[model samples]
Target: MLLRNVLLLLLCLVAATPRSWADDGYRLWLKYDKLPNAAERQAYAQGMQFVAGSGATPVLRAASAELQRGLSGLLGQPVPVVAAAGSRTGGVVLRVDAQANAGGQPLKPEGYRIVKEKNNLVITGRTDRAVLYGAFALLRQVQTRQPLVGLNLSSNPRINFRLLNHWDNPNGTVERGYAGSSIWQWYELPERLDPRYTDYARANASIGINGVVVNNVNASARYLSAEYIGKVAAVAGVLRPYGQRVYLSVMWAAPKVIGGLNTADPLDPAVKQWWTAKSDELYKAIPDFGGFLVKANSEGEPGPQDYGRNHADGANMLAQSLGRHEGVVMWRAFVYKANSNGDRFKEAYEEFQPLDGKFDPKVLVQVKNGPIDFQAREPFHPLFGAMPRTPLVLEVQLTQEYLGFATHLVYLAPLIKECLEADTYAKGSGSTVAKIVDGSLDKHELSAIAGVANIGSDRNWTGHPVGQANWYAFGRLAWDHTLSADVIAQEWTKMTLTTEPAAVRTLVNLLDQSRSIYVRYTVPLGLHHIMGESIHYGPQPWLAKAGRPDWTAVYYHKADSIGLGFDRTKGGSNALALYRPEVQQEWGNAQTCPLSYLLWFHHLPWTQRLSTGRTLWNELATRYYTGADSVLWMQSQWAAAKPALDPALYADVAARLQTQRKEALWWRDACVLYFQTFAKQPIPAPFAPPTRSLADVKQLVQLYQLK
Candidate 1:
């Protein structure tokens, strides 16, 4: 009886105990733990005596509360919030400009400036939303231990609309999400507002993302119903104060499915009226409704093409419906057919190029970063420069659908930077994809960029703790494309992982090298779309049959006895001609082309000697071997920085790194052995061959598919 009583006492004590600050990754990069260094704390605390601001609105209240919470935690003392900073020095003041252009140089609607004025830090902006952003920036500087005495910084977003396209469903499942179940509990949403929603909005606003599309592209008609609109309004209410506007992905045939219409023809009078009425209802419930993102006529989704109308017809119809409201239409350009004859790479370009000037003023054509689906590495899409008259939204995937998902530590800033910095050569050498998307190249007022979100219902927000860096990087780059991937990585590492100098440098280097290492093992030398079927995980080079020919790996790689690679040159599909004359000149020849893109444009022989001074066969084998081995190097780097990282966070990543290494080997063996069928060559020198046979690897992959 005494033992039972003691056990009950122990259980009660455990339940009552609060978790350690470093025990979970729930805080993300917003961690405001007290500084370990007394000197550093004193320096930051010197300028943060009090947080002076008015809780005039939800946004202002959020900013003030965030500052108080952050400063109190960092300074190890309560930082009180006051209505004003009159006669007070060493305090932070929030100031909003009644006139946007009243300041000497006018600030953008969402721009912020932090300066040292009269011995106090002043965060001034044209709007309350800007002040909120300024608050987060100040916290960032303090968290990174940056000096604040002489601080003067001003920043604005490069694109007009920076949005996260969440492929979440109403049924609590995320389409391509690697993290757990959906964060939005549709069943409990209208009545029970989860506090997580507020945190989600805070994180987004902190990084300058102003919009969120909270549904899948393969949308359902039910979301357009009156009942669902109320649920959406509730979510929008929480996000509105943080400068976030919610968007919905509308099914093209929603009028037919839910509004008792005979057809969803864009030109039909009744269909047009139905959409207009729906738009009015949406705006009535949520006045700040951002827009609609539509996926039509892609992958068997219903579109206006079914009724003998083009993309412009469909987009213009939606644009007309939203014209009465302050909303825009994002018409997707990711449409393709299975019968494209293994040339899906050219489909989007061919379809959208001619309709460039026909789109309505309220329509922004949303184009994926590449012509193909979100592969690890792809040449910049041909449509970027081709559509000179249309405002195109650059859509990038943060979900790692084609990368290693949440399991691998592949930093994606480099991948995004590669596309952003690519020279389209449309208006000469300096014409970059960034310029086109930012509206500077084409001189279009409407501009936008989107990142398919990697967020879900996991405790850490993202499955892998470090995966948060991708989310952070996307927001930063959307605000300013010129920010280097290296700088962003270092900042995220310090803010989210550790602030120690040595550890920060080590983790930064690890992040910088991770994407390339992943590329090498999975799809080196311009290889594309060879991942496993359906799941898009692991290696499946031997996959020959699927529902469509284009869906098969064999259709893309085109491996034969004499050579490997799909020939997109003049001798083959002639897809290279889609680019500008300059791009064609640069990538036209296999001899002068960068090896990174060699196989993309040309099919070379197995024994072909190249600029690297090795046969194609040997070089391919070397990359596969070295890439798999480099995971060991990454593991070593992580272990060396063990002392600086949180124990739980460190252990979590270490276990994931182990899994990555094993998977790397799996990729190497599977690709090397499968391609060896054509090469008929032994594994290159100084690298040991796989212990398992080709059959063994195939059997293992089959088993993985079952799991």
Candidate 2:
């Protein structure tokens, strides 16, 4: 009891520290540093004399408090929150009126509009949560130094449920996570609510992410217990004021594992009753609990398939249990057979397409961005346009599991943008993946997009400083899918780093090119799933054995003496048939297909000439060599921005770039030399031959895979 009291006291102290004002990335993009120009600061100060609001509810109080905190720092003055501005001029007013609209523009639920009323700046929204978002949007204007006059900024989320799915385990380990440990303090929770929880909630709410799944999909049933429910309730309380809800990844056999039951079958009446009871228990603990995220019959997890039932049978059962509660069941569509000989890229489509209109209204079939696991680059999943009856939640991985695991300076905005902008052709030429995800393509009411969280216990949040850009980008893009990757990168850079023109342009350009550059060195020409064994790092093209054949590097690459790519065309696995005919027409012909995706659909001869005026082997060799060399250019760009960036922040990224340069060379040498044996060609011109042999690279990879 004494020790528990001490822990609770320590948590109170941590929560009282406000925001970390250090040069570290703890503040994320929310840093409200004083404006560098005093003239500009003074002008902005006039509009923020005092923040006026009722503080009637928790969210209302939160809005006024944030305005005070943000304006106090940015203007270098005391900006107090008051009950009312009364007749005062040149003050900020926050209003939550059901009839509020942005000037003449309309607002969807949880949307905000900022406009100048009389002489005061007014931020209004339809709901208290909308006003809270408005509060952050106003702070964003000051932090980015946008003009305060003539304000008519109206913003609404494109998707209904924007979320972050944390692959955090109950025991403090994070699956595929690189930053220190899990941020969730499981042992100290329920009694000791860390201040960091509030910070995490604010960061998500600021960018319009409305929900978070707090446990790993490869789940344990312990999270569903009465004891854990109390812990989750404490977390929900902290997040509730910010309009974010707590979600759990449920173990499929929770009925058997946590509750005493005969069989964990969804159709079993006893099992149905168990879930109904469980849902009630969960809502009683956390009234606004966001529903379950289930990963079953994929990678050895238990599921409805084990009991002679399909995915719809399982998902509908859980959705029915929610009954009158306002929640959703996100049933993951990432299923693949353990020992199947079929192409893994075609597996999810083959399985889920048959049950398109069969799902309950409250269920969403969450699909990954690509057909396979989160490769550096992949053709958008066929499931996007293929499943019109079921509302699909696009699940993207933010953790750099396959993209070098937080060490490489790869910006994932480009990767995500590529997938979003791709034409699914489900409803015609302009039927983009984004349209399908936002529910406009299918005319479905429910919509969502989730990013597998990269966040952890690191003071900087993400291990790599630039990694924060991906998190910010996800939220902005989720709120509005039409926002370009370049625009998002520029916005994040100006707000997080310096607003100096030259430095901002340089950093934005670097971020724009980082994903493609990483792809060129590591997995160029549509290469997929060839990373090292279980860790999914470095290069392992020679890897041929794993527990499952599909898990081997050799299974996907299919490199041979005659060719160097997977044959997904009709002549091979016929995976191209899964896409619409228009997409097939565009991707079918090797001569016309985009060079970036040439290898994904077809396997060409080593000497076959591409439209780039280079043979297959030569183009592959050039990208590998040039990709590694471009990391040197990235190092130079970072060095040039040193004058504009914070010293500690600049140093951290500079050091990571050094490690990235080393590992990029490792990827280049390992892949080039290994593939050379099959190509039987010299290294292309403007590129020197690798100093090391393929055997040498294989030995190094073997050592990396050692337990």
Candidate 3:
């Protein structure tokens, strides 16, 4: 009886251990370890018999290894690595050359070509790194179950740099990280390199992200020291195999703090020499070192401005250090003064536009997607195409600082897509933000797009399981800004989990509607940052005081008995003048403006009637209710599709959806109750009265100070 019980116990233990089919989301979209269907296994087996590629560049070699590992696991067969193409064996050929091979059209350095030959397929590129990217692309199609027959695709990156900026400190704590601790085990790095470094590289490579900023933009001078350089080199070495280069966010005062210089002025010859020497030393440690990222003269950080120099002076000085290294400097334009005299929204444009044509060719001005910080919703930044002569890189935040953090399932692709698709009209009618960013509008040679990373040391990478989708979506959009959010969501859903057509449809609809739903409940119809003061987690529409005037919630909502919303029209900030006349015309009028953006553009009276036939207060109340109500629908949809998913994973998301639903109602109740004081009106019929008094809500907000 003891022997029989022991055997049964062993079987139970084995069964309970997590499997690839279960909810351990460590695999992300590269879930090749999961068992595959018989037909897929056979097709992949026949198509990936062996891998052939060019000279052994680390990038190319890594690509070959990844293909073999992914193919062997998915198809349950060993895939041989070959040096050159041989008699067609229904395998793949990876070609890396300066010129196209086999009569194929030539590819750009960052471009790739994938063509299906009789029984074989050729993945070719103009360079070894390009071939690496092409390999990942080919594998992605297979992982998503796309038909491989008659494959003839040629692709290139629209942006020159697709990068992730990590706001992590040297102490291993992430500044705005909602996920656990920082991913970089900084204290043990350069010697105790973790295997997770390679895993990080693999995840990034699969999605076409090629660069990483290793520290916070609020930088510490220590990263520039010799010790940190060695540590950075170690991280770079792991990333090198995956075709990724590591960039550092430098403290502008590094010359004084690290190099023993008296002053760190951009125009100072000694300071310039110190930086040049530092750059040389960095390249020696890591040959493929991406250039520096700088945030100066903003929020008390030191910069060229401290020495009475402008942004161009600071950027140009750093650009000089990277001379002939094929490196580029990204200068952040998120500057605003400590004083309250000027409008905060116009600060970045005011600072950068005049410096146009003054920056070095290798220096790209990095602008946020919105004029303000990454609020749930705001007008597009005026700087997108305002400075035609400058090379600008659009910076977006994947971290949910103003949204609900890791708690809310906000699919940010639509938000990203909204900013990219907005018409800038810099050159003419068709000069959309996409064209401006992709370099087509101004013909700028250097273009880039970046997202502030939300990654951390959580077991699943991102804290929330679904937060992984935002990272995946950013890379897909970065690779090709024109890809629709719906298409990307569907592809990710199919590749990362069950490929049941019905379940895919449900997932796509959920993701497609998610961002707008979040906005509706949290800060609907152009309502900007009203989250709780410091942590920025939940709603605090009544918050009226902060150190700075613009930092308070009431400053943005501008709620009065007459109306709600920020007025940036002709009579107010006149920010509309920054856009083309057509844009202004569309947004300048409350009667004609889109309802989704009505509050963002106009401060209409509460009694004004909207197209929906509801008064402004009534409409606002309805939107908050409807938006929160959608969370229930999302929960139901996810539940209905649960049978097709891993039980553990399904239950995890199901619980999160429950939390989201509860919080959504909290946001609705709190915002409506608070705003009612200004509107001086009763709660509309059917919407319940406030569960707590206004003073009780204030006490509830005070409890959030622990964060």
Candidate 4:
């Protein structure tokens, strides 16, 4: 009785101490930070004993450690790990059944099931990796401030494969990575495995992401070399316990570059043998290798088309080599040619819409969210339901390549939801992109979704602290698309920042309004692909020096004395014909078109009147001004809730908002000033003119290029 009283006294002391907890973001949403409420902490402390599996495995050890760490921080009590549970009522139990895994749903290698019994909780799976996933799921519940008792959750990934495509190259530099250098140190990798690799796996596993393609999609022949395969396998071993399978991006010209064969053609017998042998070698090293991601015949990459074959022949040859290995090929459909004749937007639909059923069952054609690359805002791809016989995977970019690097905060769940909710009208009215991706629309078994990763070696994983929300948002939406953006933001805010109602409302509004703000200041009214050449970092409204006409910035924005925007209706490129007539009818007429996407499909005159009493030019200028003004509102919203935020994090985010305000002004001033020359109009009353001349803004761009 004396010992029990002393323990209760200790718990009371620990509950009163708040500064002892660490603030480092390495823990992410799995922080398991202390519960502020006294009643909540006492309830969680009731079931605090640790129970282990029968055998000691690497994955089981990890599950035990994570639970210990989480419960210690959350319950304000250090729960001891034990080998068995003996009538310990209200205590946490980790039971593993090697025999009980026989009959259940067909599990993904990393899938797990967690159930609550009369006095215990069972975290089990067909394999040890599943146990590890269960541990993370339980931690998520604690972090999200949900009741842990009576928890009976069994979650398997809806998509068969959820992977991250890194644009890292053989050299240390990442193609568009804004966080820092590539995480993979190739020169030291086969031997000196960084401890950071384990932390990376933990972060990914916590979010339920199961696979990673570690190299650039633009293929490099060196990755196929035997020495580099050893390096890749080392990374795979670290991720294995966390249930993540490693995939590779293969060079289509491996036969010519690495194998020393004359041709890498799919029809050639020797080329076929080379790829088979190479795949066999990879499987020998890493038995559970996910599969290959091919970028054949896109951009400047070589493919089977060089030898008069199509994507079907190329994807099938690779899929045949992985026979019964439990893997599949992700053939990217981001193809466009150098031809100056046809519309570039209509090319991918024309090319792959004809070869739907010819692909192997193991092959999935990965299409982007839009017909083009990751633009700010775009209509849903017309190909979502164009091919009923083949399986398709939706590829969304989490990296913020087009949304403003890592600095600007744009919660992407809404953007993804916008695309998923769009009705394809392929079979009927209810056929949405979400149904097509989840395998409910076309009735195909294979279905998956991918996000281009934004992770790096930063202590927080992503560079900007708020950028972590994008990564978190992607995984949450990937698991369940029906979840609302507001709900996710509220959950993440409660777990990651503060649970104060004022702070939660402020953060949610900032996220909900963020994407529209970016679109307004950057690419308002559906104008697309006008970012600066190659780097695509900033604005360039006057670029006209690219090889193809469509490749230039001037093509999409046909600005002169008369009008602006690309005309893709029946008279112009006719790209609208790709969608069903129901979709076409809504977007076909310029006057009745949705205001969010009006400029994307039609070239309207500056003097033409809009639905509002204002002229087209006045509306354009107003949107730009309003976009800049919204940043001020965001700043004020954040400031109003500052007392509810941690001082360190509050200051960090405050500093970033200042930068955002300046950049927003830069965009508004530079774009409006340059376009004013063509429109032949004043800056309009009440709105001030640009501080600098148009020549000065052009010079600023020139100086950025020099750097």
State candidate 4's TM-score: 0.93
Tell me model 3's lDDT, rounded to 2 decimals.
0.85
What are the per-residue Cα lDDT tens digits for candidate 2 across 1-707? 67755654454344334444448889899877677687998999988888897578998888887787778778776676679889987889988888876546668879998888888888888888999999999998888778988888898888999999999988899999988789899999999999999999989988989899999999999999999999989999999999899999999999998899978899999999999999999999999999999998999999999999999999999999998998999999999987888899899999899999999999999999999999999899999999999999999999999999989888887888888899998988999999999999999999999999999999999999989999999999999888889989888999898899999999999999999999999999888788999999999988898898999888887889999788888899999999999989889999888888888888889999988899999999999999999999999999999999888899999999999999999999999898898999999988899898888888889898899
The ten-residue window of minimal lDDT in model 4 covers: 98-107
lDDT measured at residue 494 in model 2 versus the true structure, 0 to 100 = 92
lDDT of 4 by residue, 542-598 (tens): 888887777777787778899778889988889999999888888888777887778
The worst-scoring run of ten residues by lDDT in candidate 3 lies at 8-17
Q: Write the per-residue lDDT of candidate 1 for residues 110-154, one digit (tens) a residue.
A: 888999888889888888998999999999998888888679988
- lDDT-wise, the better of 2 and 3 is 2
| Candidate 1: regions farther than 4 A off | 1-22, 99-104
Q: Count the backbone clashes (under 3 Å) in each candidate.
A: 0, 0, 0, 1
Residue 36, model 3, lDDT: 49
Clashing pairs in 2: none
Q: How much does candidate 1 score in TM-score?
A: 0.96
Cα misplacement distance, residue 573 of candidate 4 (Å): 0.1
